[model samples]
Target chain A: MHWEIVVGLEVHTQLSTRSKIFSGSSTVFGAAPNTQASAVDIALPGVLPVLNRSAVERAVQLGLAIGGNISRRSVFARKNYFYPDLPKGYQISQMDHPVVEGGSLTIQVGPDEKTVRITRAHLEEDAGKSMHGDFHGMTGIDLNRAGTPLLEIVSEPDLRGAAEAVAYAKTLHGLVVWLGICDGNMQEGSFRCDANVSVRPLGSGVLGTRCEIKNLNSFRFLERAIEYEARRQIEINEEGGTIRQETRLYDPDRDETRTMRSKEDAYDYRYFHDPDLSPLVISEDWIARTRAAMPELPGAMRERLVAQYAISAYDAAALTASRATAAYFEQLVAASSGEAKLSANWMMGDLFAALNRYELDMAHCPVSAAQLGRLIVRIVDGTLSGKLAKEVFEALWQAAGEVDAIIEARGLKQVSDSGAIAAIVDQILAANPAQVADYRAGKEKMLGYLVGQAMKAMKGRANPQQLNEILLQKLN
Target chain B: MSLTLLDVKRVARLAHIAVSEDEAAIYQQQINGVFDLIAQMQAVDTTGVVPMAHAQDLNQRLRDDIVTEPDLHEKFQSIAPQVAEGLYLVPQVIE
Candidate 1:
């Protein structure tokens, strides 16, 4: 019997506000243990939480970006639980009304495109860190992260498998970063995801009990954890056992999901609307103002790129994966006045490969976009063949001077002059009489070998197209 | 609804408070008395009335996102029962 895996993700994105959501304390990471924890963050007796305006605006930006309905009035609720890291003993979150609700994100996995419906994106505060092992049988609590603003984006159970979940996650990550609402840094815990996974018989309309896997900080971990959790559920069902709705943690070291808590000891977070904070009311003017300040969204930009540059949707998607990559491509095209196809090919092919090899993102790329544009221009003007262009690109990657200077310095210019290419082609034809006879005798593949010889004799500087044309003429 | 002895004991456990059998019995009656007041309130037919989250029907005041707090860990940790290397110490709570 085939089982289908169902996944829904709850993404917690730390908003890039300068202060905590409700307290005026520094939200910067890597601070001394509790130095950034203000009186309100530490839950002093008299301190009260004042909502941050920037945090609200950022949430509104997300709502507008996803085309979600922004709640005109939202309320904060307290989730009561007992945890050492929670100084207030209760986390103030949204119970029913959230700032942003009902958004959908389109994700592309392999060749299939699917839209994952977003349930809600709520504004909440983050808990502090608890260091367990090094404190002599006691835990050390650092409240620096406490009260930091987080927008928990919940998705409906629309994803069917691990790949789709990852694609959805990546797409959401890209969107948040593009919107400038969140830094989208997973390493420092700026962006985190909790996946709710369940498995049921294929084609079943009813849902199965799900086990939520928490704190999957990376896309790889999200995929693996879901795969593991779904398999575990299916195995239990097949063996005449029951799947428990519980919370689990993924141990990447062991590559397994272990039960963190079950129904037996599950936390009953008695939720109530927080009385200390009144309802947050957003006006239409504020939404309009935020929308006016919004940048061109990636989807709209991608459509424009497709129409203006006449590139494939796949190429456009790859270019607009991040705002930086798209900006770099545009600058490259402007600098060189090169065809969009040529620029896209070079960027998607060589530039991306080099960036990956160096473990660098576009921001850290050593080669400037203009330099790359100049190199592409060289290829267009017949100064550099594709092979020789790669050689010059390497030099440029090393921060060797301008593209033209590097070509001149290394004597890497293509032998594109017709007379020069013809001479080289003639030399190759004379030296390879047997192969030339083979080509004339209608073994047409011999032309490739002749072309190779001509390129090699020219030290790989011969213009491949010109050499091929001249070589074919001589052979016939 | 009235509170039972078991309900009193469970609520005590959730709140991390210790209660004996006699205390649970007394607490159950007292909690049930409170629930009776809630039952009386629920008896009122206030259909179509909007639910109120707070006493005052007002919007939450917004604050500018500024880092106004300075380093006060030294002053704050001074009052904590246990501290080590600028961190508050507590019995290990395993997840």
Candidate 2:
């Protein structure tokens, strides 16, 4: 029987606010334990939470970017739970009215574009850390992360496979970082996802029971966890065993998910509106200001890149993966007196490969954009073949010299003179008479061999197209 | 619209408060009184009225995003039951 996977994601993005969502505590990561926690963060007596203005502004920015409705008034509710990391035994989260509502994010899955509906994005406080396996059989509690501002974005169950889920996640991650609302650091847990995965027969409208895999910080882990969970559910159904709804944790070491907690009933948090905080009222002017301040969104930028440069939609999407990457492509295009398509190919291919090989970020790339652009210009002007252009690019990366100087010093210039190419082609034809006769006898593939030999005789500096043309003329 | 003895005991357990059976019976009656009062209020036909989360009409006051808290870990940990290496030690709660 055919089975399909359905997934919904809850992404918690730590806002790049300077202070906590409800207190004056520092929200910076990697501080000495509890040093950044204020009295309000630790839930001291008589300490009340004062909402941070910047956190709300960041939420508004996200709402505008997603084309979501910014709630004019929202309320904070206390989600009652017992944990050491949460000092107040409850988390202040929005339940009824969130900051954002009813928006969609378009994600690219292979060549097809799909829009994932966003349920809501709410403002909440993050809990602290519970460091296990230390403190001599006791867990260490660090409240430094407590009360950090977080925007929890929930998505509809629109994803059909693990790849689509990842695409949706990555697109959301890029959008958040591009908007400057979140830093989008997965390592530091600035952005993380909880995936609700289920499996059912194909074309079934009713969704099967789902298991939530919590705290998938990386996209790879999220994909694997969903796949593993979906397979497990399908196997259970095949065996006539019922699926259990529960919370599961992804064990990356074993590459499988295991139940963390089984719920006999839904959690009875007895959610009540926190009387400590008043209703958060956002005015129309506030939303307008946030919309005006937002950078050009990724979708609009991708469309502009495609229309302006005449590049493919795929190239535009890849270029606009991040703001820095798109900026680098634009600068390269401006500096290179070459085709935008050529610049895009080099940027997406060799440039990215070199960055990965050297374990360098775009900011730390040794070759400047202008220098690479000059090298591309050499290829455009026939001063260097594509192969010789790569050589100059390597020299540029090594800071050897300018593009023209490198070509001069290394003799890597393309031999584009048709007269010089014809001499080499004649030498190759004379050296391979049997192959020349074979080519004359309608073995047209041998002409490619003759052209390759001629170009090699020039030590790969000859323009391949010029050599091919000369060889065809001589043979014909 | 009333709390049973079992419901009262469950609520006490959720709150992590230890209560004896005799004490639960008394608390069940007291809590049921509050529930009865709520049921009386719920009988009012107040359809189309928006639910109010707060008693007052004041909006939440916003604070600037600035770090004004000094390091008070030493003072805070001094009152904690367990502390070592600048972290509060709690009974191992890993699930």
Scored by TM-score, the top model is 1
In angstroms, the error of model 1 at A197 is: 1.1
- Residue A283 in model 2: lDDT: 99
Clash counts for all predictions: 0, 0
Cα lDDT tens digits, model 1, A272-332, are: 9998899999999999999999888998999999999899999999999888999998998
Q: What digit string (tens of lDDT, one per residue) describes model 2 on residues A1-476?
A: 99999999999999999999998888888988889988999998999999999999999998888889999999999999899999999999999989899899999888788999999999999999999966889999899999999999999999998999999999999999999899999999999999999999999999999999999999999999999999999999999999999999999999999998877744679889999999999999988887888888889999999999999999998899888889888999998964699889999988998998999877788888898898888888889888888888888888898988999999998888888988888788889999999999999899888877887899998888877777887888
| TM, every model | 0.97, 0.95
Where's the lowest-lDDT run of ten residues in candidate 2 chain B?
B1-10
Superposed model 2: Cα runs more than 4 Å off: A423-446
Q: Candidate 1: which stretches are off by over 4 Å?
A: none
What is every candidate's alpha-carbon RMSD to the true fold?
1.5, 1.9
Interface RMSD of 2: 0.7
